[model samples]
Target: MAASSKRTICIVSPGTARDNNGNWHTADRWARFLRDDYDVVVQERWSARWPAPDLLVALHARRSARSLGEFREYHDDRPAILVLTGTDVYHDIHRDSDAECAVLLADALVVLQPAAIGELPDIVRPNTHVIYQSADALPTLPGVPGRKDVTMVGHLREVKDPATFMRAAALVTAPGVFLQQIGAALDADLERLAERTNDTVEHYAWQGGAPREYARDAIRRSHALAVCSTMEGGANVIVEAITSGVPVLASDISGNRGMLGDDYAGFFPVGDAAALARLIDRSVQDDAFIATLRAQCAARAPLFAPEAERAALLRLVDNLFHSIPSIGKRT
Candidate 1:
């Protein structure tokens, strides 16, 4: 595609740069991936005010429902893709009318991971695609020789289940092990809980929502990354941890299983603080288990490579555009 002849793609996200949430990161990264071949525009919403785009990539089926609906109504002939979020697949799509409508209105559906496919309605399964988000590889920094750190990265929300991680911090008894929690407390109660835990727990620290560079640096330097979220649409933290050669200790939810594989050995039951603590202690003392985790993470790392994600995204757009001969190539 030539520079001026490229097709326009509008990515509708409910979050903006300030939000610094998963949806915004996905929208931003996908735009960069698609920009080489398409004219990509990312906005909070779409309306009649903006010129029509060849395709609309809407994030969060429920939050972006109005934008998806408006774009579909405005250009019924142009294809629109609905990107399912954790809440959408696990909660909203089953109960919310707007979310269900977004599913029906889209020409195609995209799930961040394969496990999410089982959550979608059977009627729309034929058109659904899996597009794993990507992250560039970061060099693995060696852990401090005398101490080990496990970091959990996510906002303090009910779905993320940060309480479990905080409780696990109290339960961990391994020598020279520390638990680090990164992310802003989106809820006041959770913030207070984190503060109390930090005050009492000898080896726990709550470093609220640092810069992206700091978070990535922490992951690269850690012994393991902990993701305690009960629901996830394929977490970007998992991708970052895998790409950085840091193993993950994840909740045994379908979304985490989809990202780490069913056979991975690093999962603890969701919300089981004792189980997470046991795993954390083991990850510190059991070198063999850590090695196994590293190997498994390395095996899955290729799936999140920048090249693979870009190719998959480009292929989906190309196929969707080609499916309709009349509008295959935008003038």
Candidate 2:
């Protein structure tokens, strides 16, 4: 039966509205997806201020730790979900007390891609679910009339490893291939490096940070997207690329593997610029390789459809609520 009344859900994300980061994007998207079924509010952090929500969905265990603890303390049986991020899984949860506490408090854990599940502790495994981030199914567009550019989107944080893309640009043998890097610099050193690389590397440009639509437009028109992250919960850029009918050449990390499948041919080793260069060269030199990557990415597109993600998210929340006896009793 359909619900009699709308439920109130609160999302706790560390990213600010102006951050333009992955966490902010996920929080924003999920709020829109849940709005029809529930009254959703996206917050930088959960507070005990105005009114209590029926459920809480906190992104980044460590970042939202205090908020999670507050909600759980007041209503232990009320449904709460902990969404894991790159830092949470790859680093924090293992050593950070706050992140670990969040793991113990949540009724369910959300991993953006399947491989993230492996990063969880055995005790947290049973409750964890993979929720692939999504994008609308865009019709394939005619190729852009410009020099071929492969773009990489992600802030110039150490984890994103923009250096790999820069180094790979210097190594590729393919002619007429330009590299475009999007996103702001989180590290001063990396920012300086990008500037230097742009001047020295042939056919490379760093278009530091752009509006979401601009980044999406760049990806949609590019020959392929390159993602060289050292760690990722699941890069939102990956789904954006796939749904836009652009193929990705990603780092061979679990997060990328989880999204693109382990056997995906478009992956290069993490930090291996030469290998990425060779792969990029092959993509530029051989039409078949490019076609194969596009085909594989196309097959994964359905999994990232908006409807599919909304359904999975609803089911996970609904199941958790129904199983917990005190779900509706909490005030």
Candidate 3:
């Protein structure tokens, strides 16, 4: 391990605290985790105006590409850990030159889920490691006595497919089935659609952004989580739901499959609102099916424990800073 007396670590997140998105959440958690052993701080990006730390953990490859590239240019002796977000792995790196440069320049790469490993180009695969995100367990809270509430939480983004959630809400025919969506209207067009959804769909409610604690409580109170995202590097919400003893009904995508496991029984076809609606109905009426989902979630929850995430992150930093030779050094 590196000497602990005065180590400094910097986290660069594309999303800032005001955004309260997944990237910010991870950066904030890591800052807390490393604060005791290292001088840790979180910022949207690093520039020549600010002091560089001994190490950099950047949250988005494409979005933070300038920060990553400039760090190598300016410092040339330290290490930068480039964390690949969903778009970075599946979309950005393939088409975006900045993302390509970020990967090439990284001393180490972090992918949030195991399955994302296959998406990396062969040249960078050896340097990459999977680090699952985590959420602390919430105290159990009961849902309305018999109501079946399913929730999908994410900002209104194209990749998240909130429209799917809205359509699924309309299609659900099960008695006492309620669908709630919690997210900011990041996209104005999408926000309008959600408004229409709420007005037309009696059981669907689109509650805009809430406090972090309120969101946690909402997840705990819901009977199940519907993660209809089309892409995810790894969603923190999955960890939150699983650790809170909630089962998930997710879209059938590698990201969700990667986090929830291949054998997880609760997947509906991606973007197929009818299929999602059917799954939601089944969750309410079939006790045995719901039990199976609960069992599968319980099995996966250990992988997302706070202790596990903290250890993995620290170990990654220890090896990158202490054991491995630094890359991008000008000398």
Candidate 4:
């Protein structure tokens, strides 16, 4: 074991920086958040060769199950946290045995939004905690007169439901309304579809696989951010939008409801392109509707602040450490 003064924390994430997906970003942000207090290391997988950590924080129950299971098996005394992603909350936990096993192995469970707790088994509910992700506030770009930009930020993946956004591009007839999609083409078919949409729709553009800074700037410049996901543990993009002073038009789903609140006025039905298009059109034609959305997002902004997220995260870590009197004394 390596000699270290600060107790080490290992974060296991299946995705890497190159992927630029939600899991990787979450793991990276968490590593930054916890670094001030602990020795934090983020890895795609945890291995025995690494110095034993005082705590293990694994993102994605199904994907990180093997590492989480092994860590608990060897270091039963140490705390292990399992963060349930969109797939785990809405899909995998109900059907996947490994995901269920991972749930049981965790000493603490984290859900990105509160509604996700309802998706977990009764046994896991008590241990589950909601931690809304955070992004630093960005300067809201000045809106160009006579132009309305609605931006969607997520990789071209099935879960993100990019097709809905593409189809909505064709349906939206409101002049000066441009639908911009920014993400990597994780799916070849979606890439081709995005290309077709760009060629056919006068107001749609696909700027593929941008750097994080670029994406944030795009969100900051947009009139409203569109989160068209079929599932989301809690979207980091939504937080970025709120912090950047941009409103959101989200898909109506449990995960989104948890993030935006049930009464949020800007939701379109899941996978409904026409409905999404109508919402886009309404946002362009009705300034009052846009103002309402902005006010609602502003009300929720503090919840996603870095200070609040950091305090909640540290509170959880401190509680876990104190619960086990001998947590950092491991050989």
Per-candidate Cα lDDT values, in order, are 0.93, 0.90, 0.89, 0.92
> What tens-digit string does per-residue lDDT give for candidate 1 at 261-327?
9999999999999999999999888989999999999999999999999999889999998987566
lDDT of 4 at 12: 96
Positional deviation of 12 in candidate 4, in angstroms?
0.7
Which is better, 1 or 3, measured by lDDT?
Answer: 1
Candidate 3 regions off by >4 Å? 1-4, 324-331
- The candidate with the higher TM-score, 2 or 4, is 4
Candidate 4, superposed: residue stretches over 4 Å from native: 1-4, 329-331
Model 1 TM-score, all chains together: 0.97
Error of 2 at 98 (Å): 0.8
**What is the total number of backbone clashes in candidate 2?**
0
Model 2, stretches more than 4 Å misplaced? 1-5, 140-146, 325-331
Q: Superposing all C-alpha atoms, what RMSD in Å does each candidate have to the true structure?
A: 1.7, 2.3, 3.0, 2.0
Q: Cα lDDT for residue 262, model 3?
A: 98
| Local error of candidate 2 at residue 24 (angstroms) | 0.8
Worst ten-residue run, lDDT, model 2? 322-331
